[model samples]
Target: MLSVVIPLYNEARTIVRVLEAVQEAPLPTGIGREVVVVDDGSADGSADVVAAYAASNPALGVRLLRHAHNQGKGAALHTGIAAASGDYIVVQDADLEYDPTDYAKLLQPVLKANADVVYGSRFIGGEPHRILFFWHSIGNKLLTFLSNAFNDLNLTDMETGAKLFRRELLQGLMLREKRFGFEPEVTAKMARIPGVRVYEVGVSYYGRTYAEGKKINWRDGLWALWCIVRYGLFS
Candidate 1:
């Protein structure tokens, strides 16, 4: 079974659609899917929407968890990861930026190629990508470069949210970061695991504009830089 951890906040508009897409996505034969949604204190009716969806679609195996107040994405992920009961875990955002159909592509390395972790990179393949946010793209590349410099891993999209990992391997790590910094911090820690085999695959990206509810900002990039240096060198 694969546990899909979706960390969301104030995504009332896209939450239900993304959940439906996840349920409809086709997985490898004999592989079952379980969705673990962590609502990070969304005030925009996101939690209620998820609850209603769960109640109506009981067969989808959707498990909804909530935080009393808004915590960071990492905190929500921490909660979801701890509650996950699958053999493998994959992080999925409630936003429409990532395509659910690509889950199988990211799982290929772990399922067949024996990868301990797989990253769905938005910068590698011939897959279609919505061209938006020039500065965001530059920042992501810079962060990925800095992270690679410290962790010594050749990842093209270190900030990507679409990551798949062996459940035990992930739950065993001592994670700390909470916000957008979760990306670099986890990557840094994952690289330190002895004999850990990490692979990357191309995935489609349908980025959202600021008016369309994109939440990450320049501050998160700075935090990620600090995380790369702190976790990479000290921890």
Candidate 2:
């Protein structure tokens, strides 16, 4: 089975849509689905929406966990990951930036190519992407480059949200970062695993604007850079 770990903050506007998309998403035959949603103390009723949806779709394997106060995305992810029971795990952001339809495509490497980890790269492919935020794009590339230099892995999008991994592999790692720093921290640690087969596949992106509810900012970019140096160079 594939465990979809969705870590959400205040995303009430798009929570239901994303969850429905996940439910409608197709997976390869023989691979079952279990959704683990962690609500990081959303003030916008995101948790309630999830509860209503889960109650309505009783047959769906949906588990909703909540944090009394807002923690970072990584913390929420930690909660969901600890509760996951699938053979493999994938991170899904609650926002509409990533498409749930790409789950199967990202899982292809693990399911067929013997990959222990797979990253969906938004920088590649001919798929449609919302053309916005040039500086953000540069920030992503610079972070990816720095991470690749330290970890020695040629990944196109280290900041990507869609990362799939073996359940044991992820649960075993000592992930400490609690916010946007999770990206670089995980990438650095995962690179150190012996004989770990990591693959990257091109995936579509529908990035949101700040006015449209985007939360990541320049501060997170700086945090990611620090994470790269701290985890990558030291460990």
Candidate 3:
């Protein structure tokens, strides 16, 4: 089974749609999926929405966990990961930017090459991508480059939200980031694991604008750079 860990905040406007997509996404034969949604104290009734959805779809294996107050995304993920009982795990954002259909694509390396980790790259695919911020694109590439320089990795999308991991490998890590820094911190630590087989695949990106509820910004990019140095070089 694959556990989809969704670290949700105040995304009440899109959480239900994301849940439906997860429910309907087609997985490879014999691979069952369960959703672990960790609501990080959403003020917009996102937790209530998730509760209602899980109550309505009793057969979907949707498990809802809650934080009493707003912790960051990484903190929420820590909670979700601990509660996951699947053989493999994948992180899913509670937004429309990422399509759940690509879960199949992310699983290919695991089935064929015994990949311990898989990263879905948005920059290398022929799949449809909404043309958006040029600076953000550059920032992603620059961060990837810096991360590669520090960790000796060749990943094209270190900051990508779509990542898959063997449950044991993921739960073994000492992940400390509590916000947007999760991306760089995880990438660095995962790279340091001796003989770990990591893979990357092209995936579609339907990025959103700030008006469409996009939360990341340049400050987060700066923090990611610090994370790369801290985890990649220091720890």
Candidate 4:
């Protein structure tokens, strides 16, 4: 089974659409999917929306978890990960920025090469990508470069949201990030693991602008830099 951990915030507007997309997305043959949606105390009724969807679509295997208050995306992820009952795990956002159909692409490495980890990069494939912010793209590349320099990796998108991991390997890690810094922290820590086979595949990105409900900002990028250094160099 592939456990899709969706750490949702106050995204009531897109949560239901995201859920439906996940349910309709294609997966590898013989593989089952379970959605573990961890609501991070959304005040916008995102949790209620998810509950309604789950109740209506019981065959989707939707499991809703709550945090009581907004604890951050990483915190929600931790909660969802703990409750996941699958052989493989992947994080999905509540927003419509990422395509759930890419799960098959991300899983190919695991099916063929026994990859322990697979990161879906947005900058390497012929897939369609929405043209959005220029500086944001630069910032992402800079962070990925710095992260590679520290971790001795060559990832094109270290901060990608579409990452797949073996459940046992992911659960064994001591992830400490509780916010947007989760990307860099996890990448650094995953690189340090001995004999871990990490692969990267290209995935499409439908980036949103601030006016369109994008949440990340320059401050988060700075925090990501600090995280790359802190986790990659220190621990």
Candidate 5:
């Protein structure tokens, strides 16, 4: 089964479309599906969207988790992971950047082959071109390069919000980073674990400008750098 963990905060503009895409997605034949949306204290009507979806599909097992305040993304995701009930868990964003239709592509390595963790790499071979921020791409590549040096695992996209894993892979991992540090923390620590196989596959990416609610700021780049060192050595 698949437990989709979505971190939401003031995403009312795109949550409904994203949720509907998942609802109509063609999941794997035998695996059941559950979508859990974590509301990171959105004053916007994001929770209402999840409620509406849940109201329509009782059998689909949709759940809404609300935070009293705007906790960081990592905290929201960690909460969702603890509550996830499927054998596999996937991190999905409320924005329409990543396509729900491509979920099967991301799940293939874990379900059919030899990977405990899989990331949808925007820079990989089969991915379609995406309009990107020049500095953002440069920053992402530099951080990923540093992560590769630290973890000794070559990865293309360090901060892609698309990550899938077997629930067992994350056993006992108390995630520390609350925000943008989440990705590097997971990748760094995950690379050190024994018998864990990680892979990256090409996936579609549709980036948005600031006016479109793209919230990652220039300062988050500093946090990513800290995560590469902090999780690699301290953790």
Candidate 6:
């Protein structure tokens, strides 16, 4: 079984679509999975959508968690992870930027080869990038480079939304990041542990503009940089 964790913050436009995608995904035989949505104090009607869906489909076990105020992405994910019920866990964004169909590809290594962690690397050799934005792409590459430097592993996309891991192994780590810092924090702690194999699989990513509820801004990039450094050395 896999627990699909989605952190939400005013993602009403895409939350329903994401939920539908997760519901439609064809996980392998005998694979029990759960969709856990964490609402981080979204002022919009995002929570309502999740509740309505869960009410309509009782068998899906669509769990909804709420935060009174706006916490960060990491906090929301932490809540969902604690409530998750599955052997494997995957972090999914509640937006249409990523394809939910790629869950199978992200799980192949972990399920077949007994991998400890699996990341969806957007830069892996596959299809060409559909969007053409140099500065944003460069920033992403730089973050990935710094992450690889500290973790001692070469990866194309370290901050990809799709990350699958062994449920029990991660739950024991006691992660501390509660914001955008979650990415580097996970990489740092995972690096400290031995005998854990982290591999990146090719995946598709669609970049969105600010007009479309794109929350990550220049400030968040700075926070991400700080996270990479702080977690790399101190954490």
Q: Which residue ranges in model 2 land beyond 4 Å of their true spot?
A: none
**Residue-pair clashes per candidate, as listed?**
0, 0, 0, 0, 0, 0
Off by over 4 Å in 5: none
Worst 10 residues of 5 by lDDT: 123-132
Residue 39 error, candidate 2, Å = 0.4
The deviation in Å at residue 146 for candidate 2 is 0.3
Tens-digit lDDT track for model 6 on 122-145? 788584445856787899889989
Question: Residues 1-235, candidate 3, lDDT per residue (tens digit)?
Answer: 9999999988999999999999899999999999999999999999999999999989997999999998799999999989989989999999878899999999999999999999999988687888999999899999999999999999999999999999998899999999999999989988989999999999998998999989888988999999999998876
RMSD of each: 0.7, 0.7, 0.8, 0.8, 1.2, 1.3
TM-score of 4: 0.98
Q: Which regions in candidate 3 have their CA more than 4 angstroms from the true location?
A: none
Error (Å) of candidate 2 at residue 92 is 0.9
Q: For candidate 1, lDDT tens digit of each residue in 36-142?
A: 99999999999999999999999887999999999999999999999999999999999989989998998899778799999999999989889998889999999
lDDT of 2 by residue, 139-201 (tens): 999999999999999999999999999999999999999999999999999999999999998
TM-score, candidate 2, is 0.98
RMSD of 3: 0.8
Q: Estimate each model's TM-score.
A: 0.98, 0.98, 0.98, 0.98, 0.96, 0.96
* Whole-model lDDT per candidate: 0.93, 0.93, 0.93, 0.92, 0.86, 0.86
